[model samples]
Target chain A: MSEYIISLAGLTKKYGALTAVDRLDLSIRKGEVFGLLGPNGAGKSTTILMMLGLTEPTSGSVQVCGIDATMHPVEVKRKAGYLPDEVGFYEHRSGLENLLYTARLNRIPVQEATERAYLLLKRVGLYEVAHKKTRTYSRGMRQRLGLADVLIKNPEVIILDEPTLGIDPRGVREFLDLIVQLSREEKITVLLSSHHLHQVQQVCDRVGIFVGGRLLAEGDIPTLSEKLFAGEPYIIEAGVQPLPDTARLQTVLQDIEGIRSIQFSEGLFRIGCQRDLTSAIAGAIVRSGLALTHLQRKTYGLDDIYNRYFEGGPVYEQTA
Target chain B: MIFITATLKEDLSMNRLLNIVALLKAPPAATGRAPHPFRAIVDKEVSDHLRSWRFNILLVLILLTCFGSLYISVTNIGKAVKPDDPDGAFFFLKLFTASDGTLPPFHVLIGFLGPLLGISLGFDAINSEQNGGTLSRIMAQPIHRDYLINGKFVASLIVISVLFFALGFLVMGLGLIIIGVPPTAGEFLRIIFFILLNILYVAFWLNLSILFSVLLRQAATSALAGIAVWLFFTIFYQIIIKLVAKALMPSEMASGQAVLHYQELILNLFRIVPSQLFSDATTTLLMPSVRSLGPLTMEQVYGAIPSPLPLGQSLLIVWPQLTGLIASTVVCFALSYFSFMKREIRPR
Candidate 1:
């Protein structure tokens, strides 16, 4: 079998003039946590839907677990569990009842389904409210229930669309940590789609930066940064006590080896360079009779990468 | 792009072959998997309906209509029957058709309430799941998408059938206890046929509401659309047809054949209404004396003996109406099925 548990090749979905997913080619490895990070309406959900065969691609192929998704959707669905952005349950039924219904749909035996439902509920930290109606539960609890619901099928892959949307910060953290724990424990491939970059950055082993129906970049965090900032890799920031003049600081930082550009704005300095020049820049600042209050090398995060590609940078055009 | 197009063509042909192969495979029962996925859905829907307040209220209303009409029929049995009249011997069938001036007959009450019950049961069948954000979840399950729709239709049909049969038998039992006489075999068969007709009539509305549910996004909007169609067919359609017929009526100088043709034309136009078709079918089944639904000339009725027709003859007379009802129901269900399968599935 191929390494990929989910493979999408030239998958495109169009609604009249709007191309929701445009010639997308993505493949996720077995037991790997892959994040599809993009802004809202960036075709992440559409891509996930096609992977599970919930929505057919206008043109192209989707193979999940080595089965053609469009031709054999039921087989694909059997091996893949999906959690929608705002997952909801039957309001009148208890949380356990809701999960039981899903288990039955998967044709699990009554006794085994009930045992698994309870076990999953406890794992997701919803055991207390297992017997309560879902309507009375909060949004965070509902999301946790959704997590357990996805797990009930024992699927090979889990596709989550905006899983952390509208949850509290603490809930989001706990949810991400739980996801990481689950994936590691079960060796299950997870394709999580979200516009929340930092949340996905926390759990995903690899991420694909998507925008406008195209994947601009795909790799682990460090590799992605290296790709976007190929020419000048290191980014250093320094804060000066009693604020130095912009021109003076610029001249001093420019003289250092490997320093490409220096910009002093908002009482600090932002320096882009080829390599780590923290020591060199600090030495230059102190020798120039200026007290360096704060100095740290900037680590490229998903947010920074997103901004560089979208806000204003040549990376967007280059990647396109 | 050319490569993509080539691959796509190959994929389409492959999918067609796979579909044929799947069709040739063993059916679900023979496959011997845990309970069929379809059964689970149907079971869930059945319980949901049984527990819902909307269905309970409609059930109560239907029970009230049954008892109210029975009271009318029982109280007026003396006037409705004459000892010397053989045609009036059908006392059990009269229980459904007999009406006091204050209240309509049992069949007319069913005609009004049946559509409401069907609309209530099915108007929100799809859109409610969609709006509640549960549709995508269920769609993700390992089953054919059509199972959801089919299960809903079947569940509602089963519920309607059971309720109608129970009410029919209940009325018969009560009439038997009060009158101290069991209905003859013909009367019993006629009652069974009438209950079957009621179920079919309601099924037509249920399919209609389900179609609306598939086409519209909001439950309230679909409900209102179903109600609007129901109102039009039950009330305004006949009025409009009558007005059109009046304007095109033959003058007094016209031939007897022309007048007869005009009346037949008006009758045909009126039969377009589902309730009119239902009432015609029920009257033939329940009364057995309704020999013909269309206009008959004086010559055609000149030498005819007045007698109640057998069940087979009555069925033959209403065969076209039954076909019309069944065809319309099938057409509605097919439309809903195709539209649902064609539409994209997405969270709201």
Candidate 2:
């Protein structure tokens, strides 16, 4: 029942013969921390740009909060905040000055914009260097300043492309914390694209993995795990197993509905079942007089899903 | 009813917020009413230019050149009163001497200093902005693309006018110190008129520089193009006209008559280049000896290209050339603006 903040329906962008985004259909819910997980040149940035109305889509539609971005980009832009991967600013101006300039561009009153600029600078931990010219700022400081610039308008949706790309570990942690704070406190829907799988896994409530300019898989982490590893069995280890005949065990496990295969090695029996049938198979195993010592459910993480989908695979099934 | 209802439902709060945001987005007001965005862009451009050591040194060099030329005039006057060297005195009097055998008038220094100042101020206006990455940012603003070019053209004109006034004051101060006779009001007005005409001449270069800037993005390339254009009008343009006239005019005409005929042809051809027109206009204004040019007789010179025409007429006579310069500036600006707006801001 969540509100749909942004939607891209069959979005495709082509640069000459190369398709940057191919029929990308995505829906990000209001106030959710959504991650677009993809490697370099996977059309992640292109998709974000299209959503921002900064780049035109070759075909398809982008709607932000029910307003078509292509039809009314300025209106959509007013409602959304975007942080490009490589944020650039007028280097001669001070950090505060740059933010103030962006604020004015965003239409904040001068006095209030100044106050808000100071507050945002403080929030981003850039207050100490606010007076220093941007040319003097480091990459991490610049990124943080870029974030502060986006925050000035108090946008409904925040889109950050590679927000933590060049930051140190500590800076990344702070940046992620701020993103989480924005989503949780401000009720801001966030569509973050990053190559950092671990960070995305840590922060994103739901994620969409894109490979070759198409969404390969998408859902909540556990849901995506289940979807990707569907039909891959759970491994069950028993301590009291003297030995069960492999054929018999396979037969017994397979006799149960949804169990496709069972194999035993090193005092462990691996049972493959239809997704969501793990508990049923485990119950059947318990009833078969096997003392279950360990039970572990295996699911693919973002990295595994990324490699499986993007690297080599069944070529026909690959999204591209 | 439906349309009215839809319009009423349109989020006024959000629209108001956006308007407020737009206002807040402007750069800190440096001068005037936020300078129409293009002005800020042009101001930043001019400031960035004036920051360079080369331009600073150029300004210093100009100041030195003007004063140095003035000093030479003063010392020549001192040398002219040798009492024994009558021919030298006459030579000095003809060129450097005032009606009295004293310091040279302001026009003498202006004649030498004006073109140098005009050429120096305007030869790089557009090219430097393109090189500095300001053109793209300026064009990205909502203001019309032509504004940036026009604003730059206008800004450079203002800068040239200020420089002219500065030079004029310097010469006047020096003239007072050396000549010891304050200029009459008419003479002072004439000097001011000549300075203003020099500004128009500089505008031609500024406009031409902008045209080249749009035509070429590289600062060096635009600058080279501007200098080449200046050289063409100052030197090659006249030579070409002479050669063409000699080939076409009848052999029956006397040499002096042919020369006059060739001069008229060259002047007409030169008018196509705004800088040449500007120079011609200023020369007529500053030098009393240039009473008539080509088919224009002495009476015609007074009626058509007189020394002290009203400001409006002066502007009007050169209006076509000024319009050409202004139009060229606008066109260059429009091209740059359109190209920049359409260009993808992709990371290089």
Candidate 3:
């Protein structure tokens, strides 16, 4: 097995009577994009801080790149880069200057730091206004600059707390695309913490949904759905053309052995089934000669999982 | 000139020279561990303080009053009461501690303004980092958490010492130009101690302000807390001490020794206020003929001596005040360090 780059064992953090992170165990493999998904105050940031050794865990350990993070936080930090939820830069400093300061902190030489700073600013599409004070830049530019700050040390693992927070939709897309590219091309393991699942869904290889300081489920999208929704119906949603009558569609779907339930409206049919029997259902619809314009599986995203898990419903545990 | 000009870009401020050397020589790549991060933090914080309006406004305030004090001292020193008076020995430094008529002396001004300077510099130091959202980002770097606090402390101390020394030397320089009297070696040593006293006294306030900054969330709240503490010590503290002393010891029916004891008790109580410590240290250091901070009994002063104490003897006498200022500073710093370490950096 490939070694896990980031590993936590029984990690717990408590404040007086309140447990912020409780009895947590997680592992993120090298070069994998792992998202820690949780709502506000659900301890996602606390977990991230513990993993980086910024916040000491009440019990247990964090191992980053084979180093004990708690015992050797600086060493782990040297190999890890963190972008906090709200990325702050010195307002009086130029974007390039801020990055250079981080570079110098990481002990990059002056000439080399300046060069790397310029290159990273350009990489983040902030080179045009690299010389302007950060206060003048938009929130998006400051975030991109924060990314540049983290990358200055060439960290082996990048920890981003709410990477898409407070960014415009366009900026979010650009930023996520950059993250995906960084993971793929640079082979850097990324641990992204966010309450929003759709944002992580676009880039994460695996995700851990946290509720009440407890990780409820951990897996890829399909794996999680299959496990959580096992014995529950798989849904197929379709839109039909030609002022479609519901009778024909229902009649066609009635013949399918796997079909559990079907509901048809003006042009839409929400079909619940034992499995993904879209091909069979679609074949029957075609045979009945109703023009099927669109056909897709009705998916259960993270919000549904979060709600179910939060409502004290069962979640699938990773068996192996 | 051209070659030097080219290198000037690299070392614009002598500030970053140590950082450059640290970065260039055996960077993390070679050693597999980066150099200490405090240098970078110190450099950044130093620049921030320099560009801040708080520092600029105070700089102007101090310069105006100090130069005014210098002008007054120069004019006053023109007429002398005696050729060999003890105060005449350190005529040059007298400009720093003696008032003409209207404004307070340089030492008194510093004794009052020093805490305000300290508070302004540091009251928002950490909380502003939190408010601006940079604390987490910097803490995430590959540096010890201790570096953050130590870096800020060292940087502010550097600035405080520089400001005090520059002003002290300027007043001395102006005294030289106007009065043409150079200070003796003992007088020069006394001046150095006076400036050192200012730094330690202001550093106490700086530490206190940082402590408040760590405890309070908003920058404005921390600033207010800092100023409030300053006000308490500068104004309310003495009044409260007097009231407490009066209640504790009734002088109307008390014996002479009891009154002396009461006076010493009140003076000891004043030691708690950092401004008082500063004032006591400055007066004793500047005016050597002044014997002590507390009331002296007739028996203790039976010798009737009016000689200037040596630098060592004077320091010995006021060592408690000096140590008291520094100890409080250390305690406040310790509090800030522990609070910052324990503080969970998550946003509210």
What tens-digit string does per-residue lDDT give for candidate 1 at A1-320? 49988888898999789998899888889999999998888898888888878788999999999999988989988879899999989999999999989988988776556666766776788877888999999999999999988888788888999999999999999998888888887787999998888998889999998988888899999999899888778878899877867677877666788877676656677788888899999999998888899898988899888897656654323210
Candidate 2 local distance difference test against the native: 0.65
lDDT agreement with native, every candidate: 0.87, 0.65, 0.82
Decide which is better by lDDT, 1 or 3.
1
**Number of backbone collisions per candidate, in order?**
0, 9, 0
Clashes of 3: 0
Q: Which stretches of candidate 1 lie over 4 Å from their true place?
A: A241-248, A264-266, A286-291, A315-320, B1-33, B83-86
Q: Encode model 2's per-residue lDDT on B1-348: one tens digit a residue.
A: 234324433555877555544543443334232224554545655665566565577678667756766676665555445454423312322222232324334454444444454445455554454443333322222344455556656666767777778877777777677767566564566567666666655555555566566556566776677677667766787788778766767566567666666667666776676555555555544443343344654454565522334435444565565566557546645665565445443321
The number of the candidate with the highest lDDT is 1
Indicate the residue-level lDDT of A156 in model 3.
Answer: 87
Isolated chain A: TM-score per model?
0.93, 0.79, 0.82
lDDT of 3 at B318: 86
Per-residue lDDT for B54-155 in model 3, tens only?
899999999988988777767777563257677766667677766657888888888888888999999988888888888888888878888888899999
Which sequence of candidate numbers ranks them by TM-score, best first?
Answer: 1, 3, 2
Across all candidates, what is each one's fraction of true contacts kept?
A: 0.62, 0.00, 0.54
Which 10 consecutive residues of model 1 chain B have the lowest summed lDDT? Answer: B22-31
Residue pairs whose backbone atoms clash in candidate 2: A104-B24, A104-B25, A104-B26, A105-B25, A106-B21, A107-B20, A107-B21, A107-B22, A108-B21
CA lDDT, candidate 2, residue B201:
56
